[model samples]
Target: MLNKLSLLRNKIDLLDIKLLEILSKRLELVKKIGLIKNQYGLPIYVPEREKYIIDLKKKEAKKKGISPNFIEDIFHRVIKESYYYEKIKKFKKIKPDFTEILIISHDKKISYLFKNMLTITGYNIKYIKEKNLNINNINYLFKNIGMLILDISKNFFEKFIKKLFLLPKNCILIDLSPIKEISIKKILKIYKGPVLGLYYFFDYQKNFLFKESIIYCDGRKKKYYYWFLKQIEIWGLKIEYMSVIEHDQYVFFIESLKYFFTLIYSTFLIKKKISFNKVLTLFKPISYLNIFILKNFFLENPQLYINLITDSKNNIENIKKHLDYINNLSFVIDKKKKIKIINIFNKIKNLLIFNK
Candidate 1:
């Protein structure tokens, strides 16, 4: 009986050894995945993919009569280890055209964000926070600046544009402030250097790792624009270059108009002493996005909306005209008739600037 017990103990020890070896092999496979993800500049932790993996493991565990919760706990540890390995691994360095970037912004938060992002991607960054940047500092500030990011407020933008001539001719200009088309043309006329107008519509607080960025290209400087595109991509920004006119139009309709309408609706609700929170609780099935908008509407600073609405009057009018045209279209019709009428509109649009 003692001899038989010793042999069984030895067999159990061998099984434990085999399990360790299998786990080691699994880690090796995970390392390979990290390498692949790094090559494509992909994020290490993908929430949807992680959910899929956990669900799959749970299903497999049930087939083997194993506790699903037990399998989930094991996978959680494994996934954590994989993330640690990925974090330890350094990313490949990308050699850009220029080494240093100078960020000039009135917003300290934005300046800090740019500094962090640039530092992560292996670039030397200098951040200058000034409500109204003194022209005297241009001498040292412009020196060795590969790219100059102008995130100035609209109130101080015209003055900032006047000072663009002080920048070194070699330094690529990236303008983020909203300016009139005529004003942009007038400024570019004097500044013979490369300039790229950027209209960042997406909220800076929102994650834009996979989202697209709209950039307004100026002066047809292909190489300069490409360099800017590559620089932004290094920080995981997807850039879309469009005409200045188109950029302004989109901003007016999508950003300015939307904010104005939200403000109007929010104001009306407040005046009526309506409890949006209570209404939101009653309509729990409604989308969280709509709820978020309503909740934050009154909390938003009035100055921002005022700036957008007043500054984008021309583009707002253009959008209004487009909407009026759309409203004039006949809506009540048979399915076949509606299809034919829409086809005619599509055909007309192809010949117009608003079409695809």
Candidate 2:
């Protein structure tokens, strides 16, 4: 029996080697395709193509009497790796007509992620921590910098803007502040050069930039900054242009409101004195996703969420209105108005279904 088991294990190892060889050949084809996509300025991630491949594989797996879901899970991971390799081969370095690009950020991880991506694509990139910014270094650094990226905290924005005079008049400035109005306003007041506002929906922890969207607002000269935008596209990011007001409004709803809801839900769970471990065990698939989101929220810096919730007075007012809406529903529940609740739910359900 032991001899038979050993023989089976050897066969499995041989099959694994064959699988690796196949994957290598597949990656070579992916690399060639990536080059063509880059040459034609096409997007790296084609969702319809991915969906078709997954569906095709699942059907084949079913025909072979294998679990379709298991095959799907395997293909998803394989496709993700393919994307990674494709991007690595697809980067066409567009050397900016600048001496160097300087990235200033409070977060080291954020600074380094941009630096690495830019550097690999053959751009000269330098990083300076926000805390280390002083008049002397500002003078020396800005003298040769072709592009200045401000990813610093809002608290330092005013102070940092005061030093923009040191930057060359022709150098392009990019602000990565979440609050576009404030940063753009401050920077425009001080610097008359070409300015651009970018808010990245990036998860630096994962180190994957494929298909990530960046909210960009043109501050000064679009002609000067257009190349920079194209460079980011080549790196597999999607640029979404919006006005300053529109960007801020969308951020309030997308980020602030979502965080507020997560906070309220987590607070409710804590107030009920429920065991989190037990709750996890009892959660259905949807509930499990909710729990995962809640867990991820807490894993980040608490101060970041605090600032997000309190930054805008309008956001606070909106949160109050949300609470009032919830309170009204609670009152209806207390009064056992089942017909009213059902009517409201059905109206909302129909509206959502129609919209979808």
Model 2 lDDT tens row, 1-356: 99999999999999999999999999899988887876776667777899999999999999999999999999999998888777753367665455799999888665677788788777888888888877445677877788988788767776778888878877999888777867798788889999999887767665668768888999999899898898887777888999998988888888888999999888998999989999888888777878877888999878777777777657789889989999999999999999999999999999999999
| Winning candidate number (lDDT) | 2
- lDDT (10s digit) by residue, model 1, range 1-356: 99999999999999999988998888888788777766776655666787899999999999999999999999988876766565423443455446578888877544566566567666778887765457555677777777787776665666667677877766777766664464457557767677777766555664323334556656446576565566565444556766877777767777777777777677887899989778677775757777787666556666656776667549567657756755555442433477768788788888795554
The residue pairs in collision within model 2 are none
The runs of at least 3 residues in candidate 1 whose Cα sits more than 4 Å from the true structure, single-residue gaps closed, are: 1-93, 108-112, 178-183, 201-203, 206-208, 211-216, 294-301, 319-356
Score candidate 1 by TM-score against the native: 0.64
Residue 341's lDDT in candidate 1: 84
